[model samples]
Target: MAFVGVERAVRQILQDDADVFALVGARVNPAKAEQGPATPYVVYQMIANEHHEMFGGSAGLANALIQISGFSTSKSEVLDLREKVRLALQGQTSVVTVGADTFDVRSIHLEGDRDIDDDPRDGSDAAIYGWAMDFRVGYPEPVP
Candidate 1:
């Protein structure tokens, strides 16, 4: 069987955490959250990926740069949520199963983070506060 993608594995990892679940439940989404998503949600996307090579041949390993963003009405809440995300993923190494596929995470590192405030693009007055976190994940390539 082929291995699971890092996005699926990361979502599973966040959902499996009690602290993160208590804060955002299953609101972790890919690229973006649901339309009008409730306060305190997380959105993640794979920003970059690099496959290693040795002797001009496949090295059977990869590094993925993923960005996880948390959004909420309250700035403090968004910050708290981002912190929970950090705790759940930083320095993590584990096996995650998404459906029948397995992902063996070799290492995870918190690369950077920042506060971001967004004006509603829909012309709504709701103030949206956000925090963006970047992580670099190392893992073996998926079996073909």
Candidate 2:
């Protein structure tokens, strides 16, 4: 499969994806970069993997990328999204606005990946593969 379209996939999900509010903090505090309009409030990303971005300093720039992030077509797809975020935050990237709502994402990074193993099927006495996910995201604020 082609990996080039991950950006579109991410953008599509961020805008059209349901369950957005649950992944975000209960309230918005613009004082926190990670909670402000600039940041990508991805509640689905958090829920899918049960992980959130690590924030430090003022801007909380994500230094690490989430492993097994649910957003990418492949492992490296998240990194491409990161570059898009970097460009957006630096005024180098655009067209990320979500719907008529005007939501945005920033300070992108990979949070981490989830590890999974095969499950033994008792019925057939066979092994079955399963899937797990990890979340990676960028914070809008600088690391404190």
Candidate 3:
């Protein structure tokens, strides 16, 4: 699926970055958080997809809204990770290969980002900071 292509491309780009890997250690996940990673980790999910119609009402393109979140005990560190994810995804226009299908990513637009604070799960006084970023990705339909 086109979403698969987009996810693969995003994961590949983020994992290839030395700074991101050093911080998160390959903690990128799809729609779920990793059970036991030190402090910082990343989780991504495809929230929505809207198919675009051509002049004759035939849909051949779509835009996917993907959410990538960074969680850490340090606010600054999580924000930095959010920035890294943004840089890796924004404005990408490459042809990504997923399985046996090739899809072209038209563009990646950062919709918005926010910071979250929550109490620790271990009943500690400290709070964990999470940074979430939403990216709107435009890509071609998967070849059938």
Candidate 4:
């Protein structure tokens, strides 16, 4: 399915930020990070999307709830990454372009976040520390 551009925009915004880039480089993924991926990475996914409707049928706008995950071997690193992500994204309003696609964003608001510690699959390795942050994004629906 085609998206309204929140996912791509989120990745691009994070990648473009100096602070976030320093921590994660280009290790941002859409749904899940690569297997045994590098530490201090980010993964994001859409939790919900809804199109605005007018009295006639549809409005040319959409709102989505997106969750961004920051992962690291150290709790301090993960916390720092999460703070950088939040700083880069919260209360943003802009026209963002990702490749050939563009998103006219009305706003990006920080919804909430929680700490998540992943238990190792082998049960002997050290756990992964992370935070899952939710953002509410409003933008115009994609054309085509």
* Among all candidates shown, the one with the greatest lDDT: 1
Q: Write the per-residue lDDT of candidate 2 for residues 43-88, one digit (tens) a residue.
A: 1222332223445324333322322221222334334433433332
Please list the residue runs of candidate 3 whose C-alpha ends up more than 4 Å from where it truly belongs after superposition. 1-3, 55-57, 97-102
Give lDDT for model 4. 0.87
* Each candidate structure's count of clashing pairs: 0, 27, 0, 0
Pairwise lDDT winner, candidates 3 and 4:
4
lDDT of 2 at 131: 25
Q: What's the candidate order when arranged by decreasing lDDT? A: 1, 4, 3, 2
Q: Give each model's whole-structure lDDT.
A: 0.90, 0.31, 0.78, 0.87
What TM-score would every model get versus the actual structure? 0.93, 0.28, 0.82, 0.90
Off by over 4 Å in 4: 1-4, 121-124, 142-144
lDDT of 1 by residue, 41-90 (tens): 99999999999888868888999999999889888888788888999999
lDDT for model 2, please: 0.31
Put down candidate 4 lDDT per residue, 29-111, tens digits, no spaces. Answer: 99988877878899999999989888877787888999999999898999999999999999989877777666677999998
- Index of the highest-TM-score prediction: 1
Residue 102 lDDT in model 3? 65
- Sliding window of 10 residues with minimal summed lDDT for model 1: 114-123
